[model samples]
Target chain A: MSQELYTNIAIFVLSILVGFEVISKIPSTLHTPMMSGANAIHGVVVVGTILIALEAHSVLFYVIAFIAVFLASINVSGGYVVTDRMLQMFSKPKKTDDQKQDGGDK
Target chain B: MYLVSAACYVIGLHMMRTPKTARNGNRVSAVGMIIAVIMTFLIVINKHEATMTGSIVLAAGLILGLAYGTIRARTVEMTDMPQLVSLFNAVGGGAAAAIGTFDYLSLTAGSHISFAFSFPVALDLVIGGVTFSGSLIATGKLAGNISGKPISFPGAKLLNAIVVIVIVAAVVLTIGFPVNAWWLVLTLVASLIFGILMTIPIGGADMPVVVSLLNAFTGLAVAMAGFVIDNQALIIAGALVGAAGTILTLQMAAAMNRSVMNIIAGGFGTGDSNSAAAD
Candidate 1:
């Protein structure tokens, strides 16, 4: 293996260890939402989709690349939105009056 | 830029350790994604290989998918979150597999073909295909579209055996011989079948753990794709997800008084009427 491949492998292995340690003491109520949030993070596949589009020459290539982009974008956007919704339910805004301002900021 | 985004993801996940800060965790992760997406798009646009038609197709897909994803996310009922999560896995896996397939084809057209490239390509096809089909079936079961009971037919075991044997053969062929598109395609088809077979016999009660397992499969597939392309960000993000999913699977299984081994081995569930009740 080349140096680059070796580095990538090390990165992958170390990241897995980090992932295992990323969340701790999370309540049962947060499991589903936390899972959803993690799901959204993998939407980084969207980056790959765009990278492939750079070399799409044939119609078949373009079509496949398009599907890749489409599906990945869905994963990215939907995952985040769905996660945010769930997390919001567990969120308690103490002062209801400033809710509008908070919403505006968001 | 990619490293920064990756840091954001780790920070986001760290914040998820507590309920009070979990919402912000989601935002931080989303922000990471936005940075990565914009940076990738800019790279694509600046490249001389980029074409107007390609840009149009990419943008169209991005916009359309974004609109639908947001609408579905905003409108779907909370009770349906499991299925929705499965759907996300489906898309993520499918996308990763598609990208790997494209890269494999592109690489074969050239002279330099190495084991490192081909192995990950084949692996991605298998893992991504399984995650794609498995998650879809899980989604169906969760949505009540498919029977949540263990579905064992006369040849179910035989088919499962056949699929596994074929996949193993394809993996060997994929690694030893010169690059063949059929090997990749066969690997994908067999893995997809295996995924379906594995999920169908699992009852409703074990769907959460199964979903988490398939979620991990999707992550590994993406990581394999990263290997094919030599992309660090994908490796980090995908591996992080793979580890987290595995932990979540085991955690949920333990919480439900089930073992990951038995849950993976299937037949633990007798079609529990309250499947998501454990959640």
Candidate 2:
């Protein structure tokens, strides 16, 4: 088999194993955060598109690569940012009944 | 070499799945990644005809990437962990897209478009583009960079539908008439704009669904890229990503006591859902 073919197969296997490994370590409490982070990796699509666009000898391929990278980057970045903020919401302070009672007494 | 990559992925997945064992998982994953990197270099050096300069540059890239990964791993706060994850995923998607692009460009270098590869390239392009935009929007909403208030203009869904139609038409034209490369660029720009529009309407709480969906798109795009390059690894990796993303979307929907269809159809949780149970 060609070296390229062999390398591709290697990458495919690695991705799967990594996917499982990464997911497995996530805590139940942090599932959303973890998911968000992983999802954000989708942004790599931008780099991919750039590579494709530059390397593609034809205008058509270039255009396609550009779009793919542009769109995927948004998805990856936007998704993670949102998730981070949402998780932050969990750590906020909640009002206690005692505090409310004290204020009422005052 | 393949085994090394697989090991890295496995270790990473393990860390991801078992939060209590995150440290160990991370360590394993890291080591695996290092091995994978080594394998990649070995493969390139073993087969590809390249000058010493090219080899040095490639080595530098790998080292830089490793350094970045290590730094991020050590310094990133647990609260920002999700964001980090997203960043990594984006890099992966980008890498796959880049490789696919290289394959396509090499084939079409002589101005004679190879129909066999063009389709996959297009698939990767469209899907990758959409995924990138969608992820960015999701990140903005999550990070408070943008409002998560399900912004809806009149006939937003209709507009989205129109955009999809146009994109499809453009795709058809691109394939049927390779001579018209402009259509590809036009559609790409249009779709990106449409991605932003589609995402702006999604509220914060529904962000998970959006993230999941975009991830699926990323996977599909990678898989297509794989097809274009006739790379088994890309195809398998892409399919795995797509499947995993879809499953997560469903889980998120269930968490909201909503179905995937409801999430996609739009008009969810106009803010009152905050009082409603996330369950």
Clashes (backbone N, CA, C under 3 Å), per candidate, total 0, 76
Q: Over the stretch B1-279, how does candidate 2's per-residue lDDT look in tens digits? A: 244544453444445453344334434433543443345445545664544443343334434554555456456666655445545554555455455445644543235454555666666656766665766777677767778677777666677888888888877765655444466566566666666776777875777677777767777777677666564434554655565566666667777798876665554334433444354
lDDT of 1 at B91: 94
TM-score of each candidate structure, all chains considered together: 0.91, 0.66
Best by DockQ: 1
Residue A7 Cα positional deviation in candidate 1, in Å, after optimal superposition: 1.3
The B-chain TM-score of model 1 reads 0.92
Residue lDDT tens for model 1, B115-227: 88888888898999999999999999999999977776666667778899999999888777776788778888898898898888887688888988888888888889888
Docking class of 1: medium
Please report, as a residue range, the 10-residue window in candidate 2 chain B with the lowest summed lDDT: B18-27
